[model samples]
Target: MAPHDLIEVKNLTVSYEEAKLPVLDGLNLSLSKGETTLLLGPSGSGKSTLMYSLNGLYPEELDGKLTGERFYRERPYEAFNPGELSRRIGVVFQDPESQFCMLTVEDEVAFGLENLDTPPDVIAAKVDWALELVGLSDVKEATITALSGGMKQKLALACILAMDPELIILDEPTSLLDPHSRQAFVETVISLQQEKGFGLLIIEHNLDEWLAYVDRCLLMNRNGKLFYDGSLAQGFREHYETIQREGIWVPRLFRTAYQLMERGIIDDRKEFPMELEAISPHITHGFFTKKVSYSSGIPHLSLENVTYKHIIHPLTSTIHKGEWVAIVGANGAGKTTLSLLLAGLKAPSGGTVTLNGNRLKEYRSESLWQEVGYVFQNPEHQFVVDTVFEEVAFGLRLQDLPETEVKERTETMLEHYGLAAHKDRHPYTLSQGQKRRLSIATMMVENQGLLVLDEPTFGQDEHSAQEIITLLQQRQQEGATLVMVTHDMELVDQHADRVLVMENGTLAFDGSPEELWKKGKRWLAHHQLQQPFRVRLEQAQKKGAAAIESARA
Candidate 1:
């Protein structure tokens, strides 16, 4: 360890009891003050294990055995208590909603300081300062329930900032945030880290946007072994071939440039472009320009003037059979609630939801769940079993099929979703991404007709995300209709055949992704969604072509 190192680990190994091999094996790592590092690893490759160990929660809090030493400023890692650790190393989780236990932003931010027995004056001052630094001072008193998903995450950051930790460990912080909100957050965190001079360690699956701010990169193998630790650009360039195989999310810009170069679409390129701006100039204008088709079928489910406890104001829409529909809205805009109503989880205060021309409430519980499946925003909420295998098998077994058939189907789904290796592991012990896969697999095992998923790809690496998407595509082909509530415009553009947009508690727009693009910037902003990158790029290319045409004329 260097004298200037903020944290250092020497010859660390972490292995869960149920597993045959170590998740992390003889790994050594170090971080310096004011340095920002992005840690990349496969979904269950002990990335979360390393982060948990950093904050002194390891074999002590989880079922794992650790060897060797970890040092914080040359001190023993376990020397500090929980309160002391909170003041030194802070963490923000993937789901901000899970971390929040308070009503208002001010109260939540101050909750941490108050627990440390900070004086009233100091707590008040720190809370105010933290909120101001995160640009949430005006909404400090705002109710947490009313904040958008992005705003909730910002509040989570403010809560962490209030304690003034030297190192902020963010685990998939932007997975649930919209593009604009995510961009704003990355900028804010970087600016604050630069201004305040602190160390940053971010574990993210969404890799492209973060490239602009991350200074260093730590690449982990499929087995969680540290393969490369160096400058971001050097690591990206060195491991270009093996990254996808290791389940890493290669930056879209880099991937596109590499594909173009390999296929002779773009000539005279000696090296890959890692940034979007750099790659845009080299690509042909219409390379990624493709339109999604939207066609109407018989209405499988219809909502007529549905109202959900004053949150969704007399909203009406129809979901067609075999349709991939995306429900997009800002936080608190009734996306989840409306989905719940559609699933028959909650009764509408003012209208009827009809499925197959019959009222949804008229069906039996068993029949209803088989017809309308809902996956929650937080995967852990739906977990009922202890082990990964049983969690998925529980649904299959409920229908009382043959035991061998159940086992075969369960194992097949497990392997399909990359949970076969950890079949015996506890559900709660899995990484966020692993848990999400389990949840979706559990719901899909029965082949429910209507699949309502919220942030289905949250916490997933690019490879795993693609696999899940493939599964969804399979479901679509099987005549199962899917309704997805997501802030990821890219997912909507790629998967959704139709989009149902809720704005200000009403159905503001209903059409295809192409239509959403033509809705203009201000209209999208009014609904709190950024156009997908490909959509924006296509628009820019069209404008450039139009300008050239005018000049030629």
Candidate 2:
């Protein structure tokens, strides 16, 4: 056993009761005290299972068979119950809704401390401390249902932090947060790591955001095998090609450097740049020099004084053709509600949405689906068929399209999205990224003029995210309008032609991506939207009063 290691696993194997194959097979992992490690792998690679096992949720909540040795500090795993493990290893799950037990923010934070038999006063103090750490003190008494998506995630982190565990394992903690909230959360985690030095193990697909903060990087294959474990710098240099080939998202500058090297456009004298600061000069030299101006033309889809309320409050907005608009806000900001209204899934409570001057209510539900395809946030929830091919072709099948057309469209979509190899596999058996692609393919099969996707890149790797961006770009070129609800600002900056900032079920700002950054910085901060590192770098390069303001803001 390593002296500084907080938790150690040897030959760990885990399998569910109903499954024939093990989810985790002979896995070994060691976390040292106060070290922050980033865990990277594709979906279904046992990353979540590993986090579950660390906190005793595997055998208990999951009804799984387990073998091999597990140790927390010096104690054996078998000696501790799930409750006992909670004290030593605090876990924040990927889905905020799943782990929340209490109704209010304050009570939720106090849940963990009270379970551990802490005194009332001590628990209260810890709750306050935890809330303050995550910047959730403003919503201490807010009901869980009233809090935004980012706010919910912050509350969950606060709950776990209140427990004061030695090992904190975050399972995609920022998976669903908007870009700004995600940035703030990552910064908060880095600060906590520096101040407390607790063992931090995070499972995340966004490697770029954490590259500067993590000390080490670990990769696991889909077979639940440990593929690599070492210092962050060494891993980036040695496994660069492998990571790219696997469709993992590395830092932007690193990817840019790799692409340039492949094109033989630049001399391969320097190692791949992992830090954002290092990539600034290269980006400024050529990348930002030739800026492509996108022309915004006629309105394709218009919302005339559109006002919609899910439970209460109204949201109204208009979208133009050839427009790649990102509808962004904290969770529950009516982003999803706006998407539903635009897709004709739900009629606006007041006002009207028009497609080519025709009122939305005038179109039949089935016909509306053909004109405006909507992809839900959770791909699994939208899946209806067993096989991937059948799932992707479901919409086409309903359209009563020719069998030949269905086959051709499904095959073309499958091949284009890299899902051709798994056409016969069950949709349930596919990885999270594959599932998301399948959903998009289904939506694309109809050639809808407008596509409304809620969190299109959720649960996807960097490579997959870029692929989706390309697919959306192609759709735009083909004259299909897109309205996406997202929390990823980088995705917005890279892909969106226009940005729609929402707040409390109202339209706050509707403009270009750069304009949003320039004008909505304070509003973005209030809503938990963090500016991208690229934008920050560009600001740093500028000089004078404007430059100072840009950098500071």
Best by lDDT: 1
lDDT of 2 by residue, 457-540 (tens): 887876667777788878888888888998877778777878887887777778888888876467678876767656776764
**Tens-digit lDDT string for candidate 1 (1-553):** 7887889998889987777899888889998889999999888778878887887767577676898799999998878765466578888877788778888889999888888889999998999888887667878789998786667777888899887788999988887776666777788889889888889999988776787777789999878689999877777667877787888888766677677777776653355655455555555746774543433497999999999776889978889988999999776677888888988988999999999899998999988987888888889889998899899989878788999999999999999999898899889878788889999999989999889998898888888899999998888887889999898888888788999888767898899888997898888877878887776655655666687799999
Candidate with best TM-score: 1
Ten contiguous residues with the weakest lDDT in model 2: 286-295
**Model 2: how large is the Cα RMSD against the reference?**
4.4
lDDT of 1 at 356: 87
Report the CA-based lDDT of candidate 1 relative to the real structure: 0.83
Q: Clashing residue pairs in candidate 2, if any?
A: 178-487, 179-487, 180-529, 180-530, 181-528, 300-321
